[model samples]
Target chain A: MLRLQSVRKHYDTFDLDCSLEVKPGMITGFIGANGAGKSTTFKAILNLIRIDGGEITVFGKPHTQITAKDREMIGVVLSDSGFSGYLTVNDVAAVMRQMYPLFDRADFMERCRQFGIPEKKKIKEFSTGMRAKLKLIAAMSHGARLLVLDEPTSGLDVAAREELLALLQDYLEEQEERSVLISSHISGDLEKFCDDIYMISDGKTILHEETGVLLDEYGILKVDETQYHALDQTYFKWRRKESFGYSVLTDQRSFYLENYPDVVTEKSGIDDILLMAIKGERL
Target chain B: MRGMLVKDFRLLLMQKQFFVVIVAVSVFMIASGQNTSFIVTYCTAMGMFFSVSSIAYDEFENGYAFLFTLPVSRRGYVAEKYLFGILCTGITWLLSVVCCGIYEQIVRPASDPAEQVLITAISGLVLFVPLAVMIPFRLKFGADRGRIVMMIVTALLFGLIFLVAKAADSFPVLKQAVRAVNGLSGPALSGVAFVFAVLAMGISAFVSIHIVEKKQF
Candidate 1:
């Protein structure tokens, strides 16, 4: 379990003030565009960057109070963050074994074999996908209770991504108390795996909700100008004009179905919600 | 702490400077032609340089970050570094002594007692004190910038020393004062001075660990 409360950080042109929580046994997807404070938040939580305000806690302990033993339960994978390129996969494994007491050498070697990563090959010579896979192997082999991954699938091919997703699904199924917080640009992967999604924009959380609840509560309604005027403004989360009519996002789908039988209503996808939230447009 | 030390040793094994220091000491021992004092002094200076450069290498390689993330505490890291420096200097000093002993058996067949003891003491103090003072500063700032600052400071100190030596040579009263300071003769006094220097180094090392622990990556 993780909680970030009123965490604020400032740069020359951007400011971050956001709060969120990741409950155990849930896979939470952090979705945002580039430079949307995802990496900053992760860095702050890891103490790689100093926070100007607010507190972060993991497993009920404050960030600073979390001892090295506490960190044993946390596994992290950062995009493009690693050791020198000259190190081979085996070298990395050895180094990690030294750093983590829970590190299983057999599991790590097995993962590398499963992922088709050669132990003797230098990381600099590996493709981006291979590098990502190596990092994932390193993070997962330690039997961590909480996995924090930043764009772990950014460079993978479709097959590799599917394999990774399947692995994650199996991993979650096996461990009931384990939780994961992942940020990715690929919405479809998140849609398939994440139970909850948090949409972040401009350093603030725009929406945070259960995926099923979101789909059940929100609906896209196609209405003509007249019908749009008749609809209550309070019900619209986002609305936009089309050539023939308007598409309105509303929380009460059942009410729209009963009240306006002729209007077309459909379930909105995560991408649609994300686009509308970020663009600040209403239909 | 053991993990960090093992990793540091592995990294040090890969470094060319380690080999360079070894070779330089060997050559110096051979070239000294059974001169025990020369061998000890040369090896001590080489050990000092090697210790400083190894610390620089650790920083350049981002080794500290990885080390800190492990279960080892900040104080432990500092303690390990101090131990490493002392261990390396001791080993190099021992090797030099062995080589000198071997050469003495082959050629001179006699040991100069006063010269041997003086060289060992003076060389150890000169090398260890500078290294102790500089390592914490280097770790705090960085390798390149820290080295530059250290060079400037050393230049200034040497300039002041040169001026004082010149003044003492020209003035009888100043000469007497210098003689009085240097002429104090007792192994007990030297032991006390060595203990004080080691204490200062220990305190500096502790302070360095505190600073590093509070640093935000």
Candidate 2:
């Protein structure tokens, strides 16, 4: 549903060149450290910030050409921005009612009630978890075809995060054509939720892999200097120097498991993959 | 646009206490026999400020980013603010006029209520001049810095006005021009002010749209 091809944005201190794709009915997770250009990528896709070069298309049209009507199908949850803090939930609902013809106000309020979001209190007065919930609710309430979520689970508790992920799963299950592009610091959330994952670092996309491949095939292979020298290096993606010898990241975990039985093969999660991708040296 | 209007109006309602204070102060001043024209202008100016302040609220805590993420275009956002500004300022102008008219009848029966209403109505148009200028300033510099910039600009404006008055006092050509302006009939003067106000608002809105369109977030 969305594609960004080498989208470029330049700032005084940072420059971004990113490429990503979210296919229909798929959930794509974006993982990066702070200031790694995840939010910039999201903003570029939304056309909130002007890109220096490259092209972004949403729903088969250039992002710049997407009209307000087209945006009605795009649900967005920004990390540090939201409805004006002065507005209450009721006020936001009233505004949403006008903005989206398909906005499910009843569903929105029911979700709010389910989450214990008070309808009368100013959003600024809401707790961080409550505010996060409200943003999620708003994004999910409208019958959007795609959701561009930046840190949607940032302030929520563990249970709340699980609840939100479950809700997202429900949202996707309800519509076979729907898609989501989400970024979060919490790798576990992405691991449990995303169909595919993109790893970004220093404003560039460093890795993109299906979540199952990343988890099932990718691994950290710990080896002393003797074993490292003896083992075949064919599948090693990255290697980092360690006190004992080296920590090698391999994409062919089973190959190592079957061939090099003595080597320690630890299954790599999203966090482990991100660490290796960022800190390890290519072999 | 309608969604944006609802958001801005809802934001303005957060300061319901300010509305009460404005009304209470206006009523108190009118009851104490203060100049009705000043009261009307005071209420009108105060009410118009809410529209300008809505810009600040939209910008608070990085709210503008999310606002644009909604189904709002840059031009539509600017249009909504202008429309809301007119709606807010017009309502207050009407309310102040009614209050002043009532006060004129009950407390100052000797005063020409019709003339007072006319002067107050014209002042409403003049009031739009500042609203016109403030929107672009606020949009360009943001809220806190915009307020500081506005104070400096207001000082410069007053200085310019004083200089013009001094020149009018000394130069016959300038003095005659000033006298001509002062001599125009009430309706004629209001009509001119209306045109000037509309011109200023159009330029201000244009500049504001440019500011927003060029903004990164």
Candidate 3:
């Protein structure tokens, strides 16, 4: 449903050069650290910031060519952006109901209640988690076909985050055409719901693969000194030394298992992959 | 477009200054006992300032980003601002004229000069064209910087007008040209001036929209 073709943006200190495509009915998790070009990519797609090169298309039309009606199909949630501090949650709901044609007033109010956001309380008075919930309510209540969220769960507590995720899952089950591109530093949240994961660092995408496939393809190997020395250099991503052995990350887990049956093998997580990738020790 | 307008109006309603200004204008009109023409001119000037301040508020509040994300185009956003300014000026002018007419009816009880009132209101509305043209440019730039630029431009224009008037007093050719221009009176002059003012405003709105469209949020 969305395509970013050879996108390149340059600044004095950073350069973002990546290409990505998001298909319908899939949740694409954009994982990156702060200043890792995740927000920059989102802004580029929304045209909030001008692009230095390449093109972005949504629903088969270039972003520039898409009319206002085309925009109605997409909902965006910036990390800390929304109504001014002076406005209340109800005020935001009223404004959004007019701003979006498909905005569901009943759903918005119900979500606000469910999220424990006071309807009449000023936004400035609300906690950070409540504010984030208000933005989520606005974005989801619009019946948008595509959701582009930047750290939507950042400020939420455990319960609020779980509720928000459940709400998203419900929305996903209701419509097969709906999709989401969520960027977050928290791997656990994405792990729970994301179908595909895209790991970006230093302004470039390091990996893009299905979550389950990634889990199957990469393994962490715990080896004794003898086995570690005998292992080929190409198979190890990085090694952490213990008193008796070293732990290594390898793509060819079966080969390692066959070679050394006594050595331990464990599934790798997103955080572990990101650490290895950032250290330039990918296997 | 209607949605944009409604949202803007709602936000504007939240601003206490708008209501304060309305009350202050109403009280000042009551106290000054001014002529209808003066009231019309005063209201137009106030409306211009109000519109400029509204634009500044929108920027300061980060309202543009939210508005842009909605189903509103850059062109529509610019157009609606200009339209709202025009509508505000029109409403203020109408209210001033009506209040003055009622006052005059109570004070004079016999005079019926509808044509004169209409002419004065139209002329006051025409004067707003230059203001409308200048305020959007102010908004495109930083509002504070735009205000400084506006002040400098206004000073320069006044100085130029004074120099031209002094020169015309001494120069026979310039005096003749001034006299020739002033010879046309009544509705004909007013009509021509109004047309030129509208054309200028249209050009300004188009230019402002182009500038805004090219701007990155």
Candidate 4:
């Protein structure tokens, strides 16, 4: 379990103010556009970079109080960085064996083999997909209870992404109280994997709800200019202008459908939700 | 700390060909009866740069951001660097000593004075290495920035020496102090140098740890 409470890190042009939680046995996803503070929140959570203000806790321990032994249960994968590119799979295995007292070498090697990674080949020569897989392999093989993955699905093919999601599912099924906090640009993957999704924009959480609730309740109502002029804006989350009408995004699909009997209400996808949240004006 | 050291070792492993080239050059020098002390010095210097290279490698693509995400603490990272510097320097010194020793036995017998100087240099490596590495690390100077910082440091040293020389010329006590240092016996001078080097290295390690603590990443 992980909790970030009002975490804030300052920058000249960008700032991160995040608060979220990864409950036990749940996969929580942070969805954002580029520079939406996803990676910054991850860094602050891990204490890789210091925060200006706020608290981060893992397994009920503050980040400061968390010891190396405690970190044994935390596994991480970063999109911008990883194991040194010059190292081979075997060399990384050796490093991991030294790093984690309970490192499963056989399991690691077997996963590498299954992933089609060459033991002798340096990671620098590995393809983008291979490197991503290698990172996942390292994270998953260590029996970590908390997996914090930033852009874990990047550079992976569609099938590979599905396989990775399945692996994560199996991991949770195998262990009780396991938690994962993953960030990705790919909304579909997040839609498929996350129990709860948080939409971030301009360094703030604009939307947070269960995936099923979002899909079942959230809708876009398309009305012509004349109809839009008569519709109440308070009922919608945000409305985007179209050539002939306005498409209103709202979580209360029944309200719009019941109130405006002629308005077209369609189930909103994650992509549409993100776009409206980011680009549409606030009420 | 052990994990970080292993990572550095694996980084150096990437340069296996570079080590081969070093071996080839050393052999050519010994066979040609060239000054092999240069080789030893080169190898020692290589060790220093190699340690620096490891730090630079760690910073490559902001890799430390990921590395610290693991269990290792910042103090642990700094401690690991110091140990790795000593290890690399010691290994290079031992390799050079063995090769140079073989050359002495088979080709040119090492003179007493020359051997003594070589022994001193080899032993000084332990003190020299950590200082060399710690300062660069404290400054957080990457490989390219290291050269620039080195130039700036050299200029500052030159300026300090110039001011001291002027003071010595102007003041009788300064001249006397210089003479007193020059008049020390060999053993006493060696003792002074050893003590100074140890003190400097101790300060370097302390300062480097402070720098790491102050650092955000």
Candidate 5:
């Protein structure tokens, strides 16, 4: 549903050459440290920023060519921005009703009620969690085919995060063709919800893998200095030096598990993979 | 565009108290035997300012990032602001004129109202010129910087006018041209002003659309 092919954007101190794809009927999670160009990538895909090079296509058309009619098919939630805080929930509803032809106002109000978001209060007066919920609800309310969520789960407590993630799952189930490209600091949230993962660092896409492959095949093998030198380095994607030993990141976890039984091998999560991809040295 | 209109008008409604105060002040001035023309000019200017302030509100707290994400195109957004400005400023102009007309009919039955109304109506058209000019600057520089730029622009405009007036004083041909304009019939003069306001707003809207389309969130 969405594709970015070597999309490049440059700044005084930072540069981005990112590429990722979100297939229909899939949720793609973007993982990166702060200032790793995740937000910049999202902005580029949304055409909110000018890209220096490369192509971005959404629903088979160039992003720049996406008209208001085409935009109606995409919903977006930005981490640090939303509707004017001076507006109340009812005001947002009124505006949404006018903006989106297929906006489900009843479902939106119901979702707001379910989340305990007061309809009368100005959005500025809302708590952080409340605001996040409102942004998500508004994005989903319009029968959008794709959702571009940048840190949608930020500022939410555990329960709120779970609820929002569950809501996202439900949103995907509602339409087979629908897709999501989400970025979040909470790796666990992405691990649980995403179908695939894309890791970026220093403005470049370093790794892209299925979530299942990341969870099941990727592993971190910790070994003492002697054991590290003795083991085969061919399978190591990257490695880092720890105080106790060398921590080697390998995509072929089973090979390390069978051949080097003495080395401590632990399943890699999204965070672990990100740490290795960003801070580790390539073999 | 309709959605934008709804949002802008709703934002304007948030300052209902300001609207009330403006109306109350105008009513007080008119009732206290202040110049009736004051209502038209004051209310119309306030209306224009209110409309422009909505652009600032949209940009507040990075609001444009989310706003542009919606189904709003930059061109549509610019067009909507111009339409909203006209609607808002025109409404206030009408209200103030009606208020003045009512006061004259009820309290000063012997006074000739047509000439005053004509002058006030012309003032309303002239006010559109600034509204037209301000929107593009606000779109380009944002609200705070836009205000500073507007002040400078206003100063330069006055300076240019002063130079022209001085030139007209020294040149008989220029003075005759000015006199010829002034000598036109009232309807003809008003028509000229109307056409000028429309042309200014059209050019301003085109410029604003270009500015916003080139903008990055």
Candidate 6:
């Protein structure tokens, strides 16, 4: 539903030059470290900040061409910011009623009640977690087909995170045309939820692949220094030196296991793959 | 845009102290008052500034980031602010004028109540709406530096007026122009002021839309 082509934005301390896509009926994950241009990319996509270069489109139309009517189809949640604190739950619903023609007030109130949010209390008096949850609920309560969530699960507790992720799964399952593009620090959740994952570093897209292919095929080879030197460096995708031994991340796990049975080959998760990709040396 | 106004109106209603101050000031001005115009002036000014307070709340605690993420355009947001401000300033202006008229009829009869009401309403229409619209537009700092910006703008405008008057004393042409304007009929003066206020409001809204669209959250 969303496509970014050579999207670039320059800041004083950091810059973004990344390209990625979120296909329909999929949950595409954006994984990166803090200040790694993840949020900047999100901002640029929304046109909250002006981009220096490249094109961004939502549902085939350029972001600039997207009108208020077009924007109704997309929902966005920024982790670092939120709605006015002085507003109450009722007031927020009232606002939604006016903004969206299809705003489901009953469903929104039901979700709020299920989430234990009080209707009369001003949101300013709410705790950090509560305020963050309010934003999430507001985003989902509207009948939006595309959700662009930046660090969506960061503010929640473990159970709340699970619930939110579950809701996202249900949302995707409900329709084939629906899609989500989310960035989060919780790699484990991304592993569980994302169909395709994109790893960004230093404001660039370094890797993109299917989550299953990455987890099932990609492997790490742990070996001692002497053994590492003796082996073929040509085969290892990237190698990292540790105090005990050198760890190599490789896409050819089967080859490593078949040829070099002695070298410790273990299944690699998204985090492990990303860290090695960021810090390890390439062939 | 309607959503933005919904949010702003809710914020405005939460100010209990502001309401209390308005009622207290109106009572004092009417009870032991010199003129009912004071009540109209005070209320109109209060309404104009109160419209800005909604912006303050919206920008407080990094609210604008989330605000713009909603399905509204930046220009729509600006237009909504102008509309909301006009609504608020209009309400207060009307309420103040009606209340003053009532006080004049019941508490103290004015020599010419109709003329008084006309002047009060016309002054409010010509002065308060443009001030309310433009001042909020110029306040880049939203809530934090809003008062400071308002004060600076007001001071500069008065300074400019003073300089023009001082120059008119030395320049016969300037003096003649000023005299000609002053010598116009009452209705003609009001019409000129009305057109000036409308033009000023339009320009303010146009500039505000440009600035707000370029603003980075």
Best by DockQ: 5
Q: What are the per-model DockQ values?
A: 0.28, 0.83, 0.46, 0.66, 0.86, 0.82
Candidate 4 lDDT for residue A196: 98
Which tens-of-lDDT digit does each residue in A1-283 have in candidate 1? 9999999998999999978888999999999989898988877776666788999998988876777777678887776475445567777677678778889998889888999999887677889999888877777777788888889898999999999888877777888999999999999898888999888899988889888877788788888999888876677888777887787888788888888788898888888778767764743
Error of 2 at A40 (Å): 1.4
Candidate 4, after superposition: displacement of residue A169 in Å? Answer: 1.5
> TM-score of candidate 1 restricted to chain B?
0.79
Clashing pairs in 3: none
- Model 5 CA lDDT for position A174: 90
Instruction: Quote each prediction's TM-score.
Output: 0.83, 0.97, 0.89, 0.90, 0.98, 0.96
- Model 1 chain A weakest 10-residue run by lDDT: A79-88
True contacts kept of 3: 0.42
> Pairs clashing in candidate 2?
none
Q: B120-196, model 2: which lDDT tens digit per residue?
A: 98999999999999999999999999999999999999999999999887899999988898999998898899999
Please give the C-alpha DockQ score of model 5: 0.86
Ranking by DockQ: 5, 2, 6, 4, 3, 1
Evaluating just chain A, the predictions reach TM-scores of 0.94, 0.99, 0.91, 0.96, 0.98, 0.95
TM-score: model 6 vs. ground truth: 0.96
Candidate 6 residue lDDT tens string, B94-186:
898888888788876645786777678667877655464554444465765666776787789889999999999999999999999889876
In terms of TM-score, how similar is model 1 to the real structure?
Answer: 0.83
Model 4 segments beyond 4 Å from truth?
A225-235, A258-260, B28-39, B101-123, B126-130, B133-139, B158-191
Q: Kindly list the per-residue Cα lDDT of model 5 for residues A59-86, writing each as its tens digit.
A: 9999999899988889999998999999
lDDT of each: 0.76, 0.93, 0.78, 0.82, 0.92, 0.84
Clashing pairs in 4: none
lDDT winner among the candidates? 2
Worst 10 residues of 5 chain A by lDDT: A274-283
lDDT of 3: 0.78
Clashes of each: 4, 0, 0, 0, 0, 0
Task: Give the CAPRI class of candidate 3.
Answer: acceptable
iRMSD, model 2, in Å: 0.6
